[model samples]
Target chain A: MDWIAVADVVAAVLMLCGAFLVLAAGVGVARFPDLLGRMHAATKPQVLGLVLLLTGVGLRVHAWDVAGMLFLVAVFQLLTAPVAAHMVGRAGYRTGKVDTSLLALDELTPDQEAAERAAQDEADGETEQADADPR
Target chain B: MSPATPQDAGWWARWRHRMRTQWHAALWLMVVWVLLWGGVSVANVLAGTLVGFLLISVMALPSIDYRGRVRPVAALRLLGFFVRDLLVASVQVSFQALRFGWTPHGAVVRVPMRDTGDLYLTVTSVLTSLVPGTVIVEAHRITGTLYVHVLDLESSGGADAVRHHIHELEERVLRALASDDELAHAGLGPQGTAVADARAVEAMAGDVDPGAPSVTPEEDRP
Candidate 1:
């Protein structure tokens, strides 16, 4: 009975901490200035928060099936959240939501510009070939 | 995953080759299957094996070969660091979120990864993004650069500090994953120090220069 009580106490503490982290994440998304900044707020904290909450559930429930499912959920969240964050971040960058003036330094713009120039050159070469071929 | 034998081989031979080469993936899928059902049973294992094999045959993705040996000690250390970083970043971001009237400034700094493998690049990028303040915005495959968006640019000790931090993480990753030859090729000793103290000093020096330019030296670019 004491063991159960201890587990319950631990679970309650974990759940409380997890709730606070998720609340921080929520506030971050609402308060952050840029699209990219908000993306950080949306994904990162929620990941740890979800893990904590799932762990609390695992301890509170104390069953193998629930534990297994919770483990899978945590692993999947770790794997997928970054990919989702990256997708949103890349898209936000390309769509000009990133707000460059607010940035301390920007290296992606130069790379993007360089890639565009290279693509332009390739297009020009193809155009010249078309002109020459009379196709 | 690479096929152990070419497709021109007979289907039976190919299947056998795949069975040998992709046992790990199958095992992982089996685990996933069992977990999804929230139980481990003989029937679940058999069915999961069948489904995993079937999926492998159906999926024709590009093959990625990892030529690194896993160092258990280094890998565990990396995991420890990752957990510590996760906690540190979580607290910092939470503080930033709760603080009033302070809009955080971020930077998109391209950090060159010394290791040349796609596996290393992908792993490092995923790990970097999983940490709270940093998100991988773009990756240039040819130059092996990751453009990371940092949540607190000044607090991150500026671009150079962030770059060094990622490079250090990448080194830990390579230490965990890369073979000796690969490590040497990346200018890291098996023990994770540089060929000389020069690189370490350079990293240390860069940490002091907050808001440094985003330019890599011409030699480092390629």
Candidate 2:
């Protein structure tokens, strides 16, 4: 086989694999129960898939000009993806989109539990005063 | 107002500080310019540098406070370990995804990061998130904790495993990038107890004996 033909065959396989990974990510998003879960689906495989697709493109192009640009794309994707995921995950957690029952451990629970206890005690005190005053 | 005037310090000192502040950003911008135009000839490099300086003039970024010296050997070790974890975790996540509609027991595990510098925390969190099965949901700067969402919790041993794995990653990052001062700040100075404990635990875990006890002293205490 010609050298170009070999490169084309490899690139085709990589592109297909990348497509499959992206499909998996889509399925993951649809199937996951919570926002955080979906964010994982949105990030992990998709980034890898993007890398693969870019690699495929670079392989086929085989030109330094385009290859250099492709390298930038890969670097930027890597730098941005995790930061974006971190932001979305933080928002989801703060918004109470995270289901506590499914979570193995939550450090925030301690602070939340303390707040609830304080509120409960105040409510109990108010009820006691109402009962005592016969209002 | 800027603290030091041109006469307040030596000319060389002022120039060096300015160079240090702009060099990284300028170099990165130059690289991007060259890539955008294509080719690595002398003309492209020179033009790219010119454009880079122009961009830097318009947008002055804060200089990075890099405290650590780069240890290439340690960095290579961390990279090797990270790549292995990435592949293994990716495969695991893909397998879990294959089971349609099956939601693995997911949880936000809080790992302590107290006393670690901001740089270490940022580096460790980013590294941890790149692996497929875990994502950092929240990082508490005050409390020094990272709440990581881990997939496929095995009810019995999963949380502990995740915690240990994350700590190991942090240890690796510390070894790879942390300077003496940063390590000391994190209580992992050249001969710190934390690093010692981690190594001891790692050594213990490497045992291949099936008859050996699964629980270590640390696990037993907790």
Candidate 3:
């Protein structure tokens, strides 16, 4: 078989796999029962599937620079997807939007709690100290 | 005007601060522009840089603060967990959709937000809505509660399963982001408990119909 034919086959396989992953993510987006669950579907699959699809396109086109650029695009996506998710999640939390029933662990640190308790104790202690020192 | 002296230092400092912030935003924008165009052409580069600079300058004009925040590492971990869950849920959803044909025990579940911020709430809502069968029908900002519709709940599992699943996801997000106090103080935990309680009551009252379809077959088909 010619090299072009081989490349075509490889590209087809990669494209199929990429399509499958994207479809899987779409299924996830549809099937997951909550917002957090849906995010799970959208972010992960879209990132990886798009990368794979772009890679297949690059292979088919056989342009090294185009492939390199596509790789950079993937890298940028990899870097930014989580950041966007973080920003969105933080915004959601601040806005008082969350699904509490789906959570398994609390995210607060002990130091934070201790600090709040200490502040309260200090306030109470100051009140007692003032009462005792009053002439 | 008199020759500048130490009295002018405040103005200099403020100007310096603004410049610093603008430079940072501009640099980020320029990098993004270069990636977007993907060419060494001077015209493309210049145009992109100019656009980036303008956008950054406008954005920096606002006193938007992104400080005193949690680190990004924690958020990455959360993303990892979410991906894993997504894979698992995808399999389950696909199986149910193909084999069982979209008949699910559906319910309107109320989820409480961890007091992280408005950003988190919006992110969570969009994320959840993107999931195939779940949708955010209503959100109570004052109460920090989210009402979501779930698909494909096991009939025998009842509302307890729904409550448990919701709590589990919430806890996962909180732990992933180190947001316990914010969540607890925001009454997310209690709200979850309340959902569990309500589910229990509904179960006892026989109000939950097991035959409800989560998504119709037409909807599940690609």
Winning model by lDDT: 1
Q: Write the per-residue lDDT of candidate 1 for residues A5-113, one digit (tens) a residue.
A: 9998999998888899999999999999889999999999999989999999999998999999999999999999999999998878887877888887888887777
Which residue window of length 10 is worst by lDDT in model 3 chain B?
Answer: B213-222
B1-222: candidate 2 lDDT, tens digit per residue: 246435579766755666656777889888998898888989989998988777766565655567787778878978988777766666566657778757777777656654566677788899888878789877766555677887656632456666667766886788788887886666565744665666657644743333344323232222
Score residue B21 of candidate 3 by CA lDDT. 55
Clashes found in each candidate (C-alpha, N, C closer than 3 A): 0, 0, 45
Interface DockQ of each model: 0.52, 0.31, 0.05
User: What lDDT score goes with residue A8 in model 2?
Assistant: 91
Model 2 TM-score on a 0 to 1 scale = 0.79
TM-score of each: 0.89, 0.79, 0.49
Expressed between 0 and 1, the share of native interface contacts present in candidate 1 is 0.83
TM-score of chain A of 2: 0.77
Q: Give the alpha carbon lDDT tens digit for every residue of A21-42 in model 3.
A: 7786677667755555455456
RMSD (CA, Å), each prediction: 4.7, 7.9, 15.3
Supply candidate 3's per-residue lDDT for B219: 15
Q: On residues B120-221, what C-alpha lDDT tens digit does candidate 3 reach at each position?
A: 555566555433444455555544555555554343255444444444455445544435566565344533476445544553464434355421121111
Ranking by TM-score: 1, 2, 3
